[model samples]
Target: MTAALASENLASADAAIHLGNVSKVFGKEGADGSYRAVDRLNLDVARGQMLAILGKTGCGKSTIFNMIAGLTEPTSGTVRVSGKNPFSDFDAFRGKMAIVFQSDRLLPWRTAIQNVQLGLEMLDAPPADRKDTARQWLIKLGLGGHEDDFPHALSGGMRQRVSIARAFATNADILLCDEPFSALDESTAGKLRAEFVRLVKENGKTAVFITHSISEALEIGDRIVVLKRPAMIAYDVSFNTDTSAEERTLIRGRIGEVLAA
Candidate 1:
């Protein structure tokens, strides 16, 4: 038992996320009408790694995230995060994992600093501590002077920055982003994307990023996983800062071919 435990722990260190032969079926099959959102999917994401999950619309990408986020259960197989069942241990992950959705999702009434402090509040941090943390994050995200501004008074990009700051302020063990920058204009998105990559790498937090754009995945991911219809892995490839421009173009072309298939 000691040997098995050691092995499992070691594996967890190597991969913060593990899903084995996971399948999610909604309803019964045949006449009952079943929908197989994900089928026999397998994925392993290493610790401190940023993984980009790329898929087109209706490819069941969100289903996979729902399972990981402990929002839903898979009909068959298993899903684990840092070696623990995310679903069975949903409460255990409260402040340990943070998610950023496509939209800013900021509270209209809360000031930027107030919004950033919300997560720390939920995590039960003390008043002074939370305030300091929120202020630091807002400054880090380039909103120091605007901390007192309400979401309604901020621009789209600034509101999104607050949302990102809110997530970072939690200092979570893992970050899950679902098309977070897609709503922004290309210039704003590109700028934020660069900052995001730097922050994630510097913090060494494990992350799973979901996006429909192949280029975005390539830009941000240490590893890219492409999913086909029914959420099956079509491409799993490693990328690095050292990857040349020609290589990047080739990789993009390959991903285009895979998605087009």
Candidate 2:
């Protein structure tokens, strides 16, 4: 590798995402008035780490996701993914990141496998190779037999699975999810959550997701950050992989207390 390329690779390996004293606001502050969505917030998702941001409704959870995904810019401070400004350098993340949303945003015109292949099409992959990759990912996500089905023909949970399949098919180094399973029934959501966590861990993928469900965050997050109004971190914790039932119960109680406060 050239010296510059090697240096860039090293930087990408350092931290998957970082938000340094970031804040965002909308509208005019004095005349039209404005609201601060996030207030001098700072956060980090380390390389290969899965961090969950848990908060109540209207607490700027989606606002934060927007900043991280580079759909919006910070009003002050900085948002960096792999050491690059995600908004200004948006093209830098084309192949390195993918996002899965709560609702399955499948194109109705495309079949399940075709939907998964869309990202590859943007990357200029040959049709046959894209087909193979999409099929493998669908199989991995337990949608093997449904590849030819249209979105309307599948259940809600099945469509969500296809969404996840599309995100994973690109083999992106980073994944950003916004309450991806929130629309499913309890049982279906539980199963998909387990599958999501498994694939992420097994692939050593770095991920950031936001959720309102405390239990879901506890189940999937290696690190959890609780945010309140204006999006300040109220509780930050790291969980051990081997945590006992009793300890989890205690942790749950503590998180509840903070959320209620």
Predicted structure with the largest TM-score when compared to the true one: 1
lDDT of 2: 0.91
Clashes of each: 0, 0
| Stretch of 10 with least lDDT, candidate 1 | 7-16
lDDT tens readout by residue for model 1, 1-261: 799878865775567888878999988754467889899987878889999999999999889999998889999988998778889999889898899989999988888999999999899999999999999999999898998999889999999999999999999989999999998999999999999999999998999999988879988998999999999999888978899999888889989999999
State the TM-score for model 2. Answer: 0.93
lDDT of 2 by residue, 1-261 (tens): 999878655654577798878999987654557899899997877888889999989899999999999999999988899888999999888878999998999999999999999999988889999999999999998888999999999999999999999999888999999999999999999999999999999999999988999999998898899999999999998887798889888888988998999
TM-score of each: 0.94, 0.93
Clashing pairs in 1: none
For each of the candidates, the C-alpha root-mean-square deviation to the true structure, in angstroms, is: 2.5, 4.6
Off by over 4 Å in 1: 1-13, 29-31
